[model samples]
Target: MSTSYDCSQPEPRREGLAAASGAVRAGQLVVFPTDTVYGIGCDAFSSEAVRALLAAKGRGASMPASVLVGSWHTIDGLVSSVPQAARDLIEAFWPGGLSLVLPHAPSLSWELGDTRGTVMLRMPLHPVALELLREVGPMAQSSANRSGSPPATSMEQARTQLGEAVPVYLDGGPSGDPVPSTIVDLTAVEPRILREGAVTAAQITEALGHDVPVAG
Candidate 1:
């Protein structure tokens, strides 16, 4: 069954953060809020938990999940390379809504969805998200809704969609951006837009370079 924890009280004290991370550490799923939308996440290293997350979404193995971290220092350990333009983008809009796809560490396990030598990484702007990630270290996270369904913008939506499958619902209220993050694949010869959500194509081109191909 699902448990709901409120995050209106702020970080650390917010029991939702603690409970969610606790669940993640134990290889269980927690539905939590992010800058863009709610996500059902688990410890990235836990292959079992990752499998469960995909199953919960009715997602296919070909669709990889993203990892959420608390800081830039944490990112280095997860990815193989963070290009200069990618770094510039992170410095500019991270802790906000932007997903950078970088080469994965050869040593990192890939059971967490498809991750095929690549990982979509983000440092959420919300206090609740950061607090949760800090406790869990890194989470294999994705939108808290079934695959092909509209992403949940609030805790209630997450609960409604996932129900008892999620161990805890970190209620951080509505997300700042109802849409998902703009996903840029830095692993490509030219940065490719896997998905365009919050960061506009114009904003990314200006930051990365005007020549970067805009995936329609």
Candidate 2:
């Protein structure tokens, strides 16, 4: 069975972080709170860990995992291009509820499922997640639930669904947003919304000062 920690306590917060980061570096899965919902994540650089993450969710490679970075510097280190449109979006609503798909760098040797030549990235706002991300570097994470099931907004729900498959569960209580992030693909010729959630279409349009197209 996995250990669960309440992040509100200072001592447990430190202990939880140590356990979670260790699991990540060891290529193991851990559950933590995010801005949207609870997420299951591991070191994105570890293909084996990513496979385990997908398997734990009962998902296949066709569904790609999103990358969570601690900062913009981490994003720059992993990816090649951040178009003006992406920069605008990042500046307006980053470290919050937006997931941007940018061009992946050739030098990078890690994979995030069937991500193609692009990677979906975000800097989560939750302190527990941000702290873990800062410690673990880039992590490939997805909603903490079985595939085709509702995401776990609470740590209790996540534990029930995921069980001991994940070694560490950082209990940050309920996440900020019950909904997922708005996914925008900047690698496309025009910015496209892969999925609409926390960030509205109108807000994205206004943020970019132009018309943003929608694909889904």
Candidate 3:
């Protein structure tokens, strides 16, 4: 059976955090609210957990999953090198809805999917998510829904789709709008916008102090 917690309350929040942290460490999947939407996540270092996460969503490894962290400094250790534009963008939109795709440090021994030596990283602006992430380290996360379905905006919605595949659900209420984080590809010589969502192209340009190409 799966467990759900009402994170709006103090006692539940504490219990939920502990449960979710334990699940992640045990290479089990958990659902938590993010600034944009609810996400299904597992320990980033666990290939089995990541594979199960993708399988639960009826997804293939080609699409991969993004990694979420609790702090800005976490990127310094995950990626091979932090470019100036990455730092500027992080300072501007991190802890919000901006996902940056950067080259992963070659030494790390983890597989998210066919990431092509890269990983998309984000720091969500949600307390429950941040607390759990801080407690458990980086997590391989994707929107809490099956492929071709709408992303989950509430914990119940996530449970409806993911079911018992997710061992724990941290209910932080509705996750506001279902808009996803804007994805910016930082591996290129010039930054490129892969997907525009909560963040805008103009806002990204302003952050980098230069115009970036946006994929249509």
| Preferred candidate (lDDT higher): 1 or 2 | 2
Candidate 3, residues 82-123: lDDT per residue as tens digits?
999999999999899999999999999999999999999999
Give, for candidate 3, the lowest lDDT window spanning 10 residues.
207-216
Cα RMSD of all models vs. native, in order, equals 1.8, 1.1, 0.6
Q: What TM-score goes with each of the models? A: 0.93, 0.97, 0.99
lDDT of 1 by residue, 63-131 (tens): 878899898888788878777878888888888889898988888765766666788889988888887
Ten-residue stretch with the least lDDT total in model 2: 73-82
Preferred candidate (lDDT higher): 1 or 3: 3
lDDT of 3 at 56: 97
For candidate 2, give the lDDT. 0.90
